[model samples]
Target: MTEDLMLLQEKVTLLRSEGKYKETIEACQHLLEWGMAANDHKSVLVAHLHKIASYYCIGDIEEAFNNIGTYIELCSIYGDELDKLNLNNILFLLYEFNKDFNKAKATLEVSIALGKKLNKYIIISNGYSNYSHIYCAEENYEDALKMAKEGLDTAKLLEPASPILELRVKLNMAKAYIGLENFEASKSLIDEMINDPILDSFIREKSNCYDLQGNWYSKQTLYREAFESYTVAKNLVESYNDVYLLKAIQAERCKLCDLMNDVQLGYLVQKEYIAILNQISNRELELVALRLNIKHSITDIEKKANTDYLTGLFNRKYIEYTANQWLEQASITNDNIVCIAFDIDNFKSINDTYGHLFGDEVIQHVSKSFSKKFGEHDLVGRYGGDEFIIILKNISLSDGKIKAEQIEESFKSIEMMKNGLSISITASIGVSDNSGGSVVTFTDLFQKADVELYKAKLLGKNQISCGS
Candidate 1:
């Protein structure tokens, strides 16, 4: 029965990963039934937790809250201190998401008490970090910074440093530093985060690091550097599918654009930012409707409406939104911003010869490969059919050329298999940066890059061209 339950759990995980949220909930229900029948309290708790996660993923927050209640009740009857502590943390997040800051703070207090009772340094450290986040959210920068320092101090007592917990603490501390207008300290923290190997796989944390750096630059009146930082943060959030962070970053970009006197771009980004907020609001409404057992009509639009369907990259509208923000930032700071435009060489012939499906495979393969060659902060988007554009922030013209060459080389090594036949793909890249005296708006920079791209194609497909 244990082995069967384990298999069922795996199935639930797989379903969730595949975005089959309804199926995942159904599987969890099946597991719950089995666990209850067998008198296995732990299994029952696990099943309920899984169901809660699935409901949350599906944006059915009311269902998640109900399951969380059930989980908490079960914990009361059969859980240890650690279990209760963990459940309280989850409750804290749910309340935070719902904007119930008072309740969230109360729950965090309970978690801290539980951790103290358990005498677990890690839990205590996590509690401090979460407390710092709350304070930071409330704009109490000094208190937040102090809490983060306490969290770090607690974490230092662990035999081996808890990288995940430490990272969280550092992130909160960085944000606090930004809030206090300590730009240099905030930048140092972000630089440390970027160089930390443990944070490499934690895309959100790394993204936050860049976001904080952007905020620092913004505070210092270095609008161009701030724009570059924000662009990188936005790209990372998009890549990670973090809608909440994306909305926040977009909002910041809108403000920055307005400050730069680019009212048109500001309005466009503001529109997108409001749309994301509405989506979040609708999710909250769904949660309320669920609690009342009332049916709510949810729009069936794709979650990433701004992204290209095939490559999962930003579509033209979002690219315009980000590019406009970057260009405005560059104009003010006189900082360097580069645009790289590229397309698959002979893409039409490949589509004609190998069929559209294989051509799509090539596009996906190249998109993945090209995206990997750049940092998480750099913006990469599918401009149109075969064309892709990248915004390289804070990079010199010489470096942009070197990076373009590297991308071209990377594309040359891509092999896509169809019908057991191996197909090699290549791309022509054009590089242009704001370092060129005449480049002004994003459109101008992109046009310059496009000209270089045309040169690359004319000089023989698979090569790179750079604009002076």
Candidate 2:
């Protein structure tokens, strides 16, 4: 029975590798039944876990949970701390996707405790690393940093020469330092890692390290270097269809485009973006898998022509193009149009004090907050670093200010960076409505809003000063 189960497991693994989730799940079920009949708990548990993993792979949270619940029950029955760690980690992932930070934290704690009890150093280190990730999600950089270091130290003790461990620890630490505004330190660590001969031979580590390095450069406003790093990371990730790294690298590329002030070019890069997004999305179909790894070879030449990379917001060039078209229609219909300009207060200080990593978190948080606060018809874009512009269709100046205020308040609720340290953000806003006159050009409106934004900044950094 064990041998049969092993053979079944191998075949299922091949199917899954080929992206045949449906067939793999069916095979897994058969193996599971056989293992259960033979009272082979280990094989049974493995089958259950693999199926759960597959469910998660396709973004099926509910089904993933169903399988996980059974896996946990079986693990408890057999007293397998290792399996418990795996289950806990999966739960953490689910909670993370659900945005249930508190639950994720609890799950990670349980996983770590189990690891310690079982004397599994690797699991314990991994648990700590996972725990730190939760803090990262909440923008708690201080605690995240401490935990990352602790995990690295533990991992070091277990596998001193392990490039994988070294790179991961350094990467997380670099992120923490970035949030803390220690750019030099962050750069130094990244340089050392990249220069190391060991990283060259290890694909995953080399790829991830370069990604981190690219992010750091982007935060420092080093556009060309940032682009290079992102390019390298993307190349490495695409070679293996590594979904996690694929998204991460794509994000870095987005940031690079923002720093370069080249939104059109960035969009071109995003055309490949849609392709990759579709590939990951299709993981649900359970169709033939053609190696679902990220296409690392996607070059800047293949992205969309209308999207920005940083903050995942549309770029100014795209916004201008869109706004102009809308303006033409509104003028013909005698409809109202409004434009808003906003800036993060002391953005440079945020970068200087907390580091660019934290600075990035602030930008992303603000961008997402704005999206949630505004109407669907409203157009928003990252005008540049520390700046954003919005276009409102058929909205009043008062309403625009209200919307701006709501977005600013939402930003206040988010920590600028997640790890351990806590940081807050503030912005100044300027709004203009088309009600002022129908003869005004889009550029005129932009200038007026820019003036208002500057006045808001002059009044004081944290307050939103709005005007016509």
Query: Each model's TM-score?
Result: 0.55, 0.55
Indicate the worst ten consecutive residues by lDDT in candidate 2. Answer: 293-302
Best by lDDT: 1
Clash-forming residue pairs, model 1 = 232-377
Please give, for residues 274-372, the per-residue lDDT of candidate 2 as tens digits: 777777677535322321321111122113334568776778766886787777777788777778889888889878977898788788888888778
Candidates' C-alpha lDDT: 0.81, 0.75
**Per-residue lDDT of model 1, residues 51-161, tens digit only:** 777677666677679779779889999987767776887788788888787898898888878877877888888888988898988999999999899989988888876
Clashes of each: 1, 39
